[model samples]
Target: MSNHQNPTHSIELTREATNRYVARNAAGVEVTFGRGEDLMSPVELLLAAIAGCSSIDVDTVTSRSSEPTEFKVEASGNKIAEENGGSHLEDLNLSFNLSFPDDEGGRKAAGLVDRLVKLSHDKYCTVSRTVEHGTPVAFETEISVGREEDGNKDTE
Candidate 1:
C-alpha cells in the first residue's frame, strides 16, 4: 500500500442557483458568488485575490514598523471577449491607499511603503506571480445524476 498526501489547500464550491455558488474553505469561511450586481462574479473575485495578496505582503511589512491606521486596495481590469465564446481579463490594475500615524515611526514606515509594494509584486505575491507566469491550470470534474432535491431535474 502507498500513502499519498493530499494538496495543502483546497476549497469546496456548491452551486446554489443559476450562476450562483457558495465556496467554503477548510476553516468553514464561506463566500457567496453570483453573476449579477447582487454578488461578486468570478472576475471580481480574481481581481480581489490579486489585490488581497499584494496587500497582505505590504501590510505584513508595514505592521512591523508601525501600526497602520488604514489600508485599502481597489482592483480593476478589463474583460476581453474571445471569438470562441469566452472572455479574459486584461489590463489588471490595483490601487492601494495606506495611512499611518502622524509621527516619526509612521513617517519612516511610509518611506518604505513604495519599496514594499514593489517587492510584493516582484517576489512576494503568489497570485501575481501565477498570473504573470501564465501558469497552466487543470480542472477535474465529476457529475452526479439523479440526486435528491438538488433544485434541478434530469429529463432522462
Candidate 2:
C-alpha cells in the first residue's frame, strides 16, 4: 500500500460560557461562537466554513484573470432528523454569485466562473470534500487535571 503524507490542521476550542466557545488556531487567531441571536451557532459556522473553503479555492483561480466586482458564495442545507434520533444535512449546496467587469480581462474571469466552481466543488475545497466523503473522525478524551508548572516532562 502506498502511504501519502498529509499536513495537519487543527484548532482548539475553549468554552466561554454556556454553549459558547472560542476557537483558536495555531497562529493564535480566534473566533467566538455560540447559540444566541447576536452570535453564530455551530450549524451556521459549518455552512460558513463550507462557503469559505470553496471561496478560497475558487477565488484563487478566478482572480487570476481579473478581480471580480462581486464574489459571493452562499452555502445552505436542510438539517434532517431521523427516527433513531440521528440528524444530518441534506441537499447541501454552495451557490456562487459573481460579477466581473465588461472588458477583456473581466470577460475571461467571468468565463471561468462555472468551470472554476466545478473544479472547486469536485476537488479543491477540502471542507466539502471531507463532508461528501464521510471522513471518519476519531474522538478521544484526556483527563489533564493541570498543566505542569514548568514545560518539562519526565518519562520515567
Candidate 3:
C-alpha cells in the first residue's frame, strides 16, 4: 500500500467487565484482556499499534523489491509527569532492529526504515501520528544480516 492511502482496519472489542475487554482485529487475531492485567495497558497498546503499523509498511516496501526479508520489531517508551499541568507522555522513544539476508541486504533494508518511519509519522500509522501530536517521539533503527548459523538460511 502507498503512503498516500490509508487502509481501514476494523477492531471489535467485547467488554468483559469494567476496565476489561477482549479485542480482535479484522484478520481474526484474538487478544484477551483485563484492565492492567494483560498486555493491553493503554500505553502498551499504543506502542504495539505503532510498531505494527511501521513493521507492515517496511515489510511491504521491502517485499516489493523482491529481496527476501524477515523482521522483528520491539518498542518501548517512558512517560514522565507533565510540567505545567499538560498531558502525559513527555517523551517517547522507539527502536527497531531489522534483519536481512546479507550485508547489502541489510543496507537496503536500512534504507527502507526511514521511509517507513516517515510514512507512519507523517501520513500513515494513525496511532503513531496521533500519539506524536501529543508528545515528542523519537525513532532509531538498526539493521543487520542474519547469519547462516542463526537458523535463518537453508543449508545444503
Residues 1-156, model 2: lDDT tens digits: 874769899999999889889999999999999998788989899999999998988788878989999998889999999999999899999888999999998999999888878888897888989899999999998544445758544443
Candidate 1: deviation at residue 79, Å?
1.0
Q: Give the best candidate by TM-score.
A: 2
Q: What are the C-alpha RMSDs, in order, of all predicted structures?
A: 4.9, 3.3, 17.9
How high is the CA lDDT of each candidate model?
A: 0.88, 0.88, 0.70
Regions of candidate 1 where Cα sits further than 4 Å from its true position: 1-7, 148-156
Off by over 4 Å in 2: 1-3, 144-156
Which residue pairs overlap in candidate 2's backbone? none
lDDT string, candidate 1, 1-156, tens digits: 774765777899999999999999999999999797799988889899999999989888888888889889999999899999998888988898999998987988888899988999998898988898998989887565886686674655
Between candidates 2 and 3, the one scoring higher on TM-score is 2
Scored by lDDT, model 3 comes in at 0.70
Clash pairs, candidate 3, are none
What lDDT tens digits, residue by residue, belong to model 3 across residues 1-156?
A: 554645765688778778888889888897776566454786677778788877777777876544546567787776766677754554566666666666665677667777777776677776777776665657676444654655574444
